[model samples]
Target: MDLNQRITAFSNLSLFLKNFLSDATKCEATLNDFEHLKEELQQVIQTANRHNAWFTPEHITQALSSWSAALQKDNLTTWLDAYAITSSSEKRVAVIMAGNLPLVGFHDFLSVLITGHHLVAKLSSDDQLLMPFLARVLIIIEPGFDSKITFTKEKLPQFDAVIATGSNNTARYFEYYFKNKPSIIRKNRNAVAVLTGNETPQQLEALGDDIFGYFGMGCRSVAKLYVPQNYDFDTFFQAMFKQQDVINHHKYANNYDYNKAVYLMSLFPVLDNGFMVLKEDTNFSSPISVVFYERYTDVETLKAELQSKADQIQCIVADDFSDEDVAFGQAQNPKLYDYADGVDTVAFLLKL
Candidate 1:
């Protein structure tokens, strides 16, 4: 199938997903031939929660909603407009997905297929169901996709290129294994918010979404905070209180209790607001239910430091900070063009 056909199929899949957001039963009528798949998708969502405790129904729905918003025809067209999608040589691209969040490696999956290449996806054990199910939906929308997608748990066969996402240690293995092939191997990275102590309560509440969404599991989740020196915690804590409902999830609450116990036992200084913990630390990757913070003496100096450590960061959340920085609460809602790790997946695939 051609680019327009692929885009139309994905756009239809997006519409199908929109119906499944809150109540799949209510939206089943909207589905065309995939009406039967609605019940199946609902079961997958239910089973996903059992397979991965972090994949709560609410979190999975949030992920579905994000994809639904992203896969609009206009959004897809605008994102693909910048790239020349002329390559007809279809190469098999192996994708090793990460399972930190729902559909975490979907962008790569989408990129490989949308670029007219075949995909050999090795699904993350933590996220084994969702993508393959979506692949089925895509095939129903565009039957040609059946021959283009493959999911295997065994060793990947020879392929023209590879895209892998994993922790830093696993990235080393990916680099070594795929040395002969074109590759984009990603490593662990965290997002941080730069606080000027001037944000309104609404902004801070939105910032809470950046911090607590997906229970701070995704790389785009704000794991660290860079606040002005002597910044009062009262306002920040008050604003974040709106997200206290996150603690109601048993998995998140367990992490909160365990991390807090460890901190208290160690006599480490921490600010607690019942649902989450804020601790001063230099690390960007914070434990679940905890947010690490650091004091910045000046914006210029902090900006320079952050720039120097760009490779270690996935996103920077700030207001009027820089053209590259994501706005408060907008980190998780990255657009199609917002390439992860600053690497263009489409460009890489087109070249292959």
Candidate 2:
């Protein structure tokens, strides 16, 4: 398929997702060819939830909604407009996906196929169902994709290049294993919110979404906070009450109980709101159900500190702080062009 054909296929996939996001039973009239896939997709969501406790239906729906918004024809066209993309020599590009969130490695999948390369993906056991199901939907939309995608459980076949996402330790292994090949190896990174003590209640509530979405399992999920000196915790905790139901999940509740017990036993001071805890900490990565925070005396100094540790941070959430920072609730709602780890997947694929 040509570039326009690829773009149109994805756009149709987005519409299919929209139909699924809307009530599947009611959407059959609108989703003609996609109608049969709706029930199967629902089954996959159920299987995903059963296979991985972290993959809640609500979280999976949120992921689907994000992708639905991203794959619009205009969004695809505008994002691709930046690159001088044409057909390239088709090479097999392998992607090592992470199972942190539902459909987490989909962007890499889309990147390989959209750039006219063959895809050989090893699905993470925790998230094995969603991507391949979507690939089936894509193939139905444009049969050309059938020859271009492969999902395997065995040792990955020989490929020209690879893209892998994992923790720092696995990154070292990937770096060594794919040493001779052109690759993008991603490591763990956390997002942080910078609070100036001037945020309105609305903004703080939105920030709650950034912090608690997906049970804070995603790299883009805000895991830490930077607050001005002597910043009061009252408004922030109040704003977070909207997401209090996150504690109802047994896994999250267990983590909260365990972490809270550890902190109390250690005699460490923490601000608790029944559902989540905020601890004064300098670290970027925080435990589930806990948000680490550090106080900053000045913006310039804080900026310098974050810049020095740039590779350790995935996203900075703030308002009018820096052009690069994501807005309060938008960290998880990244556009098609918001390349993870600041590496352009399409550009890398194009080079291959």
Candidate 3:
């Protein structure tokens, strides 16, 4: 299929998702072709939490909503127009997806196929159902895509290029194994927020979305903070109370309990507000239910330090910290062009 065909198919997909998300049972007649798929998708969303507790219906809906907004024809066309995309000989691009969040690796999947390449995706066991289900919907929208996508359970088939997301250790293995192939090997990275004492309660509450979204499991989730010395915790904790319901999840509650107990057993000082813990640490990647924080004496000096450690940082959440800084609560809501780790997947795929 040509570029316009591809774009139209995906835009139709966006509408399908939006219709189901807005009201699953009352879809427009134009979506008659998607009627059965809509019912199936509802069941999938309903039971997703059973497959993976983190895939709560609310979070799954949030993911679908984000994609529905992102996959509009205008957004897809504008993003693709930035590059001189062409119908070159199709290359087999293998994608090893990470399942930290609902449809977390979809951007890569979209990058590969929208570039007119065949996709061989190894879905994470935790996210086995959603992507393939979406793929089926795409196939139904454009039968031309039927031969272009593959999901595997055993060994990955041969491919011209690869994009793999994983922990630091798995990244090392990917690097060595795919050394000869064109690849993007992603490692563990987390977001950090720079908080000034002057931030309004609204801003602090939005930051809670960055922290508690996805149960603090995604790479864009704020895992640490940089605050001024002697900053008071009273206001911060108060704003965070809005997200206290996150503790209702048994998995998250267990993590909070276990981590809190371990800190107490170790006799380490910790600030707790019932749901989340604030520990004074310099680490960027914090455990579930915990957020590490450090005091910064100067913004300029802190900027330099963070820049020096840029490889380990996925995003910086601040008002004006840097040109690439994601706004207060927008980390997980990246635009189509907001590539991961500052690496443009389309550009990389074009080169391949």
Candidate 4:
């Protein structure tokens, strides 16, 4: 299929996903091949919770909604407008996906296909179902895509280039394994929020979404706080209380209880809001149920420190903090053009 055909197929997949958001059981008339794909997708959604507790129905729905919003015809056209996409000799591109959040590696999948490359994806065990199911929808929408997609549990076959995502440790292994090939090896990165002690309650409340969304498992989740020295915790805690319902999740609550007990036993001072814990720490990556916080004496000094350690940061969120800074509540809602780790996936694929 040509570029326009590929775009139309993905846009159709987005429409199929949008139908399932409100009521997956009630098949919509607009869906093509509605009966078969609808039944399969519904079953996947119904059992996703059983496979991974983090894939709660609400979280899965939110992920689907985000993709639906992103896959609009206008959005896709605008994002791809900057690139000169030409049909070329197709090469196989292997993608090693991360399962930290639902559909986390989809951008890579979309990039490879849209750039006229075949995809050989090794699905993360935690997120094995969704992508492949979506692939099936695409194949049905455009039979030409069937030859372009592959999923495997065994060792990956020879491919021209690779894109892999994992922890810093696994990244080193990928770097060595894929050394002979062109690749993008992603490492662990965390997002942080810089609090000036002037944010209104509304902004702080939105920041809570950045911190607690996806139960704070995704890389874009705000894991640390850079606050002015002597910043009071009362306002922050009160604003975060809006998301107190997170504590009801057994997995999150278990972490909160265990981490709190461990901290208390060690005699480390911590601020708790029943659902979340804040501790004075210089580190960027914090444990689940806990957000590390460090006090900054001056904004300029803090900016320099962050610039020096840019590799460890995925996003810096604040009000006009910098050109790259994400606003409160937008950390998890990145647009199509917001490349991860400042690496351009489309450019990488096009070069291959």
lDDT per model vs. reference: 0.91, 0.92, 0.92, 0.90
The whole-model C-alpha lDDT of candidate 3 against the native structure comes to 0.92
TM-score of each: 0.97, 0.97, 0.98, 0.97
Scanning candidate 3 in windows of ten residues, the lowest lDDT window is: 24-33
Candidate 4: which pairs clash? none
Clashes of each: 0, 0, 0, 0
- Score residue 281 of candidate 1 by CA lDDT: 99
How large is the C-alpha RMSD of every model relative to the true structure?
A: 1.7, 1.5, 1.2, 1.6
Candidate 2: C-alpha RMSD to true structure equals 1.5
Candidate 2 per-residue lDDT, tens place, 1-352, comes to 9999999899988888887898655442244556568889999999999999999998999999999989999999999999999877899999999999999999999889999999999999899999999998888888899999999989999899999999999999999999999999999999999999999999999999999999998899999999988999999998999999998999999999999999999999998999999999988899999999999999999899999999989889999888898998898899888889889898898888
In candidate 1, where is summed lDDT lowest over 10 consecutive residues? 22-31
Candidate 3 runs further than 4 Å off: 24-29
**Tens digit per residue, CA lDDT, model 3, 1-352:** 9999999989988988888887756443255556687889989987777989989999999999999999999999999999999889999999999988999989998999999999999989999889999999889888999999999987999899999999999999999999999999999999999988988988898999999999989999999999999899899999999998999999999999999999999999999999999999988999999999999999999999999999999899998878888888898898998878889999999998
Find the 10 residues in a row with the least total lDDT in model 4: 23-32
lDDT by residue (162-202, candidate 1, tens digit) is 99999999999999988999999999999999999999998
